[model samples]
Target: MLAGHAASGQAPGTGPGAAPPTTVAAIQQLDRVEVAGRHYDNAVGSTDAASQGTIRAELLKSRPALRPGEVLEFVPGVIVTQHSGDGKANQYFLRGFNLDHGTDFATFVNGLPVNLPTHGHGQGYSDLNFLIPELVDRIEYRKGPYFAQTGDFSAAGSADILYRTTLDEPLAALTLGQRKYQRLVGAGSSELGQGLKLLGAVELLHNDGPWTVPEQLRKANAVLTLSDGSRAEGWSTSLMAYDATWTSTDQIPQRAIEAGFDRFGSLDPTDGGNTRRSSLSGEWHRRTDTGATKVAAYAIDYRLRLFSNFTYALERPATGDQFSQQDERTVFGLGASHAVDHTLGGLPARSEVGLQLRHDRIRVGLFDTQARQTIGTTRDDKVRQTLLGVYGQTAVELAPWLRGIVGLRADQARFKVNSLADSANSGASSDHLLSPKLSLILGPWDKTEWFVNAGRGFHSNDARGTTATVDPKTGDPVDKVAGLVAARGMELGMRTEWFTGLQSSLALWKLDVDSELVYVGDAGATEANRPSTRRGVEWNNRYVPRPWLLVDADLAWTRARFADASPAGNRIPNAVDRVASVAVTARELGPWSACIQWRYLGSGALIEDNSVRSSSSLTTNLRLGRRLTPKAELTLDVFNLFDRRVNDIEYFYESQLPGEAAPVADKHVHPAEPRTIRLMLQLGF
Candidate 1:
């Protein structure tokens, strides 16, 4: 499965430019490492209270990758699953919390939520497979909720991805690389005409044949943006379009091979799925005489078809039969924000408010025939979500060195699900949510800052529009769910750059989530649980010793607990117990620069019937590249320098009942190509 997720949130701190370190401790600390006002800076010390290092651009480029999974070794408290020739997919955990779908850590893009809001019957899905690494301009991560103004998931903090804007110098970049085990990658981007910018990339990647299994990857993407710097009297208007295709069919270990596991299987490279997504968005900003107001509207069309050919099953034989599944989704959304600068309580303050509306449609088709035949069991559903939100915040100096910001964001969102069958639609329900936030920045000395924040937030229950299965045999899928989920509490702290070039932050938090989402009992049964709590801590920091050389590190630890669940009770699942990374790079060696990166993940734990068990593991990857010319470049990449197996997946099979009956299987980590090297060159002029 090829998927991706975005890490984003509003960049921290109110300061927008370089200013002399004031007497404010918190403000100074935040400002030192956050010299980013361009793209999106996630490592802005203001967000992570527990951060021990920073992940700035120089630090990032030293071991740059186009997606979060590729940069796994750089961030602590996270684990990555890599196929010999496939893309990186992460299983997230911060502090000790368990992430959804193995990949925790919520994602965002330009402040736009990407976690698929699904039917209330199941947990929301995050599609992190579409993240294109080359398009990113900057990445900022905060370990704990130390200096953050706002964040999602009461426990785990947030990471922001800042894409390059349509700024000067007519941006352009192309990457061409090869893996000893994988095929190749050819990606490029350029500016089109005036008022418009364009970017496109494609990968035909593959892995080694002599290795245990054969893996391959193919994908393409395009993006176009037109900007009018006139936001209706000092505002800006932008018209944008995005399209992409992704498919991955790598090595599939056989059932017997996975048990204790026999290690015998020939490579079958053509298997995974094919996916396409298209979206168009319009954004307009008005800086009229009456403050500034911004509005955006968007429409998205997404479709995916997966040809899952069974190669491995617990007790089941490798079914020659394949399940060709297809999913279609359409969504529409609108958001508007208005900021006003004024004086209240004899202090200068700013207030901003916004709103969002989204309509989603989903269709899942299960085709039962082989020979590439199609017989659709259409199960279609639609959901309308309306979110109403308003916030009021003000920052004032209680003294020359102390500043505080308090704000309340009230949000009411309702989800109405309607099934294709009228009888099954009664399960449709609605949920509303409101959250409050507050924070403070204290600068007690020059070039440094200290911050603390607290807030209340919540995630609503999903209504998938299908009725519950009343009968075990003819299970019913039905009525929409109602009422919002339980509210959560959060806290944060941060300190950064009292001087220049170095910054850090640390945070600890806990979240009590109500109506947990999960899959229970049968093969296709999905349901929501009673209550659960997620708690963890994160640390991030950055250090720049020279203009061309940079170094950085990060760590996140999480603990997610399922609480009061009837079918299952008080359990903590295994996600990486701890994740950490270190990167070093210098790009000024006359077009020849070297970057080295190291990643470490402690162990994951199994939460069942109360007690916990751990799976200890670790892995690392490295790469070296040279810029051949202005438009062409070459890179030599190596994965698993020491060839360490770290992934473990335990499962029970029930179908292959025979004299050769083996009920369960353990999937060992089969990532990284053998010790191989390749060079790629790309050019576009």
Candidate 2:
């Protein structure tokens, strides 16, 4: 059968009610042109509501990112920033949720989960420094909890980054910037045999950054893939490896900066981190006249060692409060899915069933450190976490202008912890959750659709939190927290493409969680307590008025708070109130192209009482390029074009300095990078 027919069973210009194919091989003579072009478009036209969108390769190429992980900023309402070294994971914010190290937002690349559970630094810690943006084909993102294909760490949203299977041509690029920044990348794909292809890519980078301590970041990344067959029937295997190390300049107290300290100065120069990740993954797929089936599996080896000093002299006046968080782990997972077209009450309907399983074996520890040397141990444990999930979803065309989707998902998680700190804390815990999802889509009137979506979702707590018996610091008794926290979400949204070359979407969403997962920086663990709620409105627009010009805009406003009344007040700390972005791109403008983008992050509460708030920040970036030849180009990128002096991140907490008699509440801030320019040269063969 033609790849498109086997994959989707839809013909050109077909609507949602297209008929199923009669024979698998009937259209085999037809090439897979449609399938190739619709790969990313399918994500946009899928049965999901307006809260979902896709970023294609064209958009990725048009935007210039200060950091590799900033590619995720393409997702509406997402803000990507870094408070530490460039080699570390970027901090993430979405929909009023401070998703510290990716606690509530799931991220996937080429079917491999990027979020790590039961990590030493925090729960669901995700690091995207390994990703090579040039190798990505598209990013599919969904907000809220309305998708059955999503599970843990998906309460707020999820993004699946798909890499390119093959490159049209070989590519080599080199970049140089201020402050000793340098990078080199090479990627290409080649045909091996009939229906077989090979792809490979490598990236290396080093940067001192604009820091008083000199970040001295060094990173290397590589990916290799082998594949055969068409989208209708294909098999692929891939291997990826990444390693990085850097000296971090952690957030500094605003008081110190005001006291004549440099904004980029470091309190503890030894603060830094080292991380490595290697993985092997494979996938198989088959398409029949009735449906399609896919299976995927992956195995990963990961390690991390981070040293941070947040409280300075709060705990140890002479030795400082510096500590180390370490995690070494192996992860294995498998997923299988099958989709079929069927009749529901004699109505055109589609059904999909999927099963997912994952297991993690981890050795995690926390230790007090002075000058990056361990002084004493706090907690050390070996944890094994396993999860199994099953889900089924159905979509039926209820009428010519209406469609309904219903889905149910069940997940079971088991955790076993072997604590070296205290035998009393070694234990096993298990939890199961059942979530139901529903979505209603109405109308295509004038190329517009309205949707209503509601669903339940959850995130797994840190294994240590599930079985802890005592505070490692004070030896005081402590209660164990739930192994899993649940969340519920609802959204009313609309999508419109009535205007030619323009697509727009608006969504009003609300989410409530049974408890918030707070990262205890000093303790090096996640604490689950205090129920929370968030409500927000988002509007996104993309306009392509001409073949060479594109304009895009997105805006979000949110309110987040603690569900229960408290003496400290109900405001959720670090929950941003507003976010806005605008971008304009001119591509292939007669060998000259340009792009300008502006991003805004509004002020937010720094503490529960909301007595102190962070200052809003706005920054702009510009990119100009000139095509030297059909296969060669040069580009210049100017980041923080206006040289806005602002804080990248802010936190309100208690800290004690060298001469202080007691701890005092103050604001800790990481200043944003100043204006800098980078030039890049690219060659294609």
Candidate 1 local lDDT, 1-685, one digit each (tens): 0001112123221101101111111222334343333212333323313332323444444564534454433444554443322332334445565445322244444334444544211233444455545445555454433322332332344444444443323323433333333333334445555545444444333333333333344545455544444324322222323333333333344444445432324333333455566666655555533355556666778775655433333312443344455557787766665555555587544455555556666664344324234433333445555545455555455554556666666656665555553334435444455566656656555544455666565444444422433322245543234444544546555554544766555666666655555432122234544566667776766566665655656666666666565555466555445677766666668878877666675655454443445445554556677887776667665555576654423222233223345543333333333334445454545
Provide the lowest-lDDT 10-residue window in model 2. 9-18
lDDT of 2 by residue, 179-222 (tens): 99999999999999898999999999999999989999999999
Which segments of candidate 2 are over 4 A away from where they belong? Answer: 1-47, 519-521, 525-528
Best by lDDT: 2
Steric collisions counted per model: 106, 0
Worst 10-residue stretch by lDDT in candidate 1? 14-23
Pairs clashing within candidate 2:
none
Best by TM-score: 2
- TM-score of every candidate: 0.77, 0.94
Candidate 2 TM-score versus the reference? 0.94
lDDT of model 2, residue 416: 96
TM-score of 1: 0.77
